[model samples]
Target: MNHISLYAQSLVYIVAGLNHFLNPRTYLAIMPPYIPAHQFMVTISGIAEIILGIGLLFRATQSVSAWGLIFLLIAIFPANVYMATSAKFIKFPAWLRWLRLPLQAVLIWWAYRYT
Candidate 1:
């Protein structure tokens, strides 16, 4: 059961990382204007996700990978805030947008579980 959960977590990050490259505009759209180099940041995050996800596959690296994800999630939280608060993102339902804020906490906790 532990292994299954670990693998599932890994899959989630791997796919999410891939999505950054495959659909960068989605991430870019939500980025706060205050953040510089949207494209570079997205690419770096994607690569980090891929590397950390792979790291979780090994016992020696699982804890470290989990810590990295926790930090990554925290680092990108401003984008989530931007999506929720910016008038430009009004197309999304307000409730759903607001909900993403708490979802970040869930994701942080999820990563912490592996630590």
Candidate 2:
């Protein structure tokens, strides 16, 4: 079960990272107004996700990779807040938007398990 979950989480991060490059507009849209260089941030985040996800597969790097993921999730948290609160994202249901905030915590907890 541990191995299964580790692989699953790694895959999730890898695909999500890829999605940043494949659908950059979506990521850009949710970036907080205070953040600078939306495109660059998206690109860097994608690269980090890909690297960390791959690192999780190696026994030597698994714990460090999990720590990286925790920080990454924390770093992007403002975007989740922006999505929930901004009028620009009003098309999404209010409940769903708000749900993203707590979901980040869940993601952080999941990453911690690997650490």
Candidate 3:
């Protein structure tokens, strides 16, 4: 993989991971109701993001991390869908909510590139 791509991906994940803690409520709000233990799941996913982000920085772990991120993206996709469908629950504009759907695909592709 290109150094720039790897660096960019690492940065995105790290920042996002940090945001999970810095703004846990934002994440908690978007979570679907069917998923139980919202707080616990949010924190666990945040920790996973941090560890995966750090792992991406190392050559030995890059592939594993990339795969992990792809899995993470897939795993959390329902939240994206929930955000798009349940627009009233989110504070963002309708356009932004709809955009998240495609953005999830982009993120998945981005992580797949690393693998």
Candidate 4:
């Protein structure tokens, strides 16, 4: 169970990191309207995610990486809330609509356990 959970967390971040490079424009599209220098901010976020994802792979860095991700998730949570509220623009299924909010909390909890 521990391995599965850690692997899942690692996979999520790794995929997110890849998406940062592959579909960077899509990531940029999700930035909140209130943020300035949107493209630059998106790019910076991508870099951070990628670095954290890589760091998570090492046993030595596992705890710190998990903690880092928790903070990162918290920092970007507003975007998730914004997307959830703007369903017209987002258009997710009802089940998945509010799912991420709680999922973030769970992920944070699980990540913290590594430390």
Candidate 5:
């Protein structure tokens, strides 16, 4: 990945990870029904994002971090689907919820580039 893309990816993950703690309710509101322990899952994923984001900055860890992020994206994909399919559960507009589905794919592809 180019420097700009790498930096952007890192920032995205870092900021998002921080947001999980700063605004856990937003994330909790979207947690799929099938997923257990919503709060724990959110916190764990937040930590993962922070670690992966920092890992991406180093040459030694970039590839592994990218793969880790790709796996993380895939793992969390069900939440995206749930959000898109169950718009009534959340306050977000239908368009925005639907938009997130494709954005998840883009994020996966972005992370894959580094692998």
Candidate 6:
């Protein structure tokens, strides 16, 4: 289960990394309005994600990847909070809607443990 989770998480991050290229405008749109130099931010984030995904591919780098992911998640959290508050961007089932924020914490913990 530990390996399974790590692999799954790694795959998700890889896909998300690719997303920066596949949908560059959408990725940029997510940046908070106060942010400047949106293009640079998106490109840097994409590169980081891809690098982190590759790092997670090896056991020797797994712990470092885990810590990197934890910080990555923390860094993007304000976007999650923004999305949660802006119903225009998020629509969760009644049961799951309330769980999103808390689940981010759980996911961070889970990655920390299994990574």
lDDT of 2 by residue, 1-115 (tens): 9999999999999999999999999999998989999999999999999999999999999999999999999999999998999999888999999999999999999999989
What does candidate 2 score on TM?
A: 0.98
Off by over 4 Å in 3: none
Return the top candidate by TM-score.
2
Clashing pairs in model 5, backbone N/Cα/C closer than 3 A: none
Per-candidate clashes come to: 0, 0, 0, 0, 0, 0
Q: Using alpha carbons, what is the TM-score of model 1?
A: 0.96
Give the TM-score (vs. native) of candidate 4.
0.83
Whole-model Cα lDDT per candidate?
Answer: 0.93, 0.95, 0.88, 0.76, 0.91, 0.76
Candidate 5 Cα misplacement greater than 4 A, ranges = none
Model 6: per-residue Cα lDDT over 1-115, one tens digit each: 7678777888878898899999998767567777678798888888778888777878899889878878887877765665566565555564454566787798688668746
Candidate 5, residue 26: Cα displacement in angstroms equals: 0.7
Q: Candidate 5 residues 1-115, lDDT tens each?
A: 4999999999999999999999999889779999999999999999999999999999999999999999999889899888889855567788888898889889999999898
Name the candidate that leads on lDDT. Answer: 2
lDDT string, candidate 3, 5-85, tens digits: 888889888889999999999999889999999999899889889889888989899889989999998889899889889
Alpha-carbon TM-score of each model against the true structure: 0.96, 0.98, 0.93, 0.83, 0.94, 0.79
Residue range 5-72, candidate 1, lDDT tens digits: 88988999999999999999999998899999999999999999999999899989999999999999
The RMSD of every model to the true structure, in order and in angstroms, is 0.8, 0.6, 1.5, 1.9, 1.4, 2.7
Give candidate 6 misplaced runs (Cα > 4 Å). 87-100
How do all the candidates rank in terms of TM-score, highest first?
A: 2, 1, 5, 3, 4, 6
Candidate 5 or 6, higher TM-score?
5
